[model samples]
Target: MRPDYPLKTDRLVLRPFEEHDLDDLHAYRSDPEVCRYLYTHCATLEDSADRLTKTLTMSELTEEGQWLVLAAYLPEAGRVIGDVVLKWISEKHRQGEIGYVFNPEFQGRGLAREAAEEMLRIGFEDMKLHRIEAQCDPRNEPSWGLMERLGMRREAHFRQNEVFKGEWGDLYIYAMLDEEYARAS
Candidate 1:
């Protein structure tokens, strides 16, 4: 399903990535600290451009494996501060996943939470999904904390589940069901 563009939140506009967003996208993505817990490393301008191209086509989630990515644009700042994503994981099971990343400059202000909550709303309400999950490195306290704040329950903590950044890494999974979402809402 495609979201109505420019999904409006209290203080931000979540929209599809545009050509002009390259500089802003690169600004934070190039920071090593911002990319620390993420799968991707600090991005160069070229890397950011390539990633931006991919995100441009991710506005629609019509099938399993597709991702719906939205730029989290802060109006007062007049630029994209980060992005939120929802992945269509399983069609039959109606399962999805939510994720977000914000510039360090905007980190503690609850902007990521605001954007991620919108993705959960889209997954449970608009996509009509049975469950939505989020996974993160166990050491990424802010990420797991955000998931908890969103009302998702900790579902699992897999020890040394995968090789990450050249080392074995633990993963923490958090999930929420549609019924859970309904009750919480």
Candidate 2:
């Protein structure tokens, strides 16, 4: 139930994050454009390093559940270009959330979609999670579209749910059930 540990797609390798991934993560995560719609403030190299270290060690630090933070790597370059994370929302409820971020340079190439599909398959089939949810800022049309393409239904729209960069922002929730995925497949 450790969320399949690692997931893979045709052109991408999805594996657990490592400390060595910090520098590569800093390259894109520190960019303003990449963090814009993600509601993430700009990150310095140090900040990215901190985040990478924390993500890499989260599982070891916890005793109950394993939260997999995976890096998406290209086969040709053998470099990480994105990350996908599955966080256990509650052990009792058996609920979890899925999140991802990709380098802008690699956007629109279906890399995110491929990685997401792989993660979804693992989440539903291997993890046995009852509900898998994804949230995004409403302004991020592409991300919303990606959720739709993944067959997740828009379950909720919370207006002004968060304040980011001095302004209120809307958050859209998309969810898929294991049964729903099974039926779709």
Off by over 4 Å in 1: none
lDDT of each: 0.94, 0.80
Model 1: lowest-lDDT 10 consecutive positions: 1-10
The estimated TM-scores of all candidates read: 0.98, 0.90
* C-alpha lDDT of candidate 2 relative to the true structure: 0.80
Model 1's alpha-carbon lDDT is 0.94
Highest-scoring model, TM-score: 1
- What is the RMSD, in Å, between candidate 2 and the native fold over all Cα? 2.2
Identify the candidate with maximal lDDT: 1
| Tens digits of lDDT, candidate 1, 95-137 | 9999988888988999999999899999999999999999999
lDDT tens digits by residue: candidate 2, 20-138:
88877887898888789776678888889888987875532132256667889888777899888777676667577788888888889899989888778767776667899999988
Model 1: per-residue Cα lDDT at residue 114 = 91
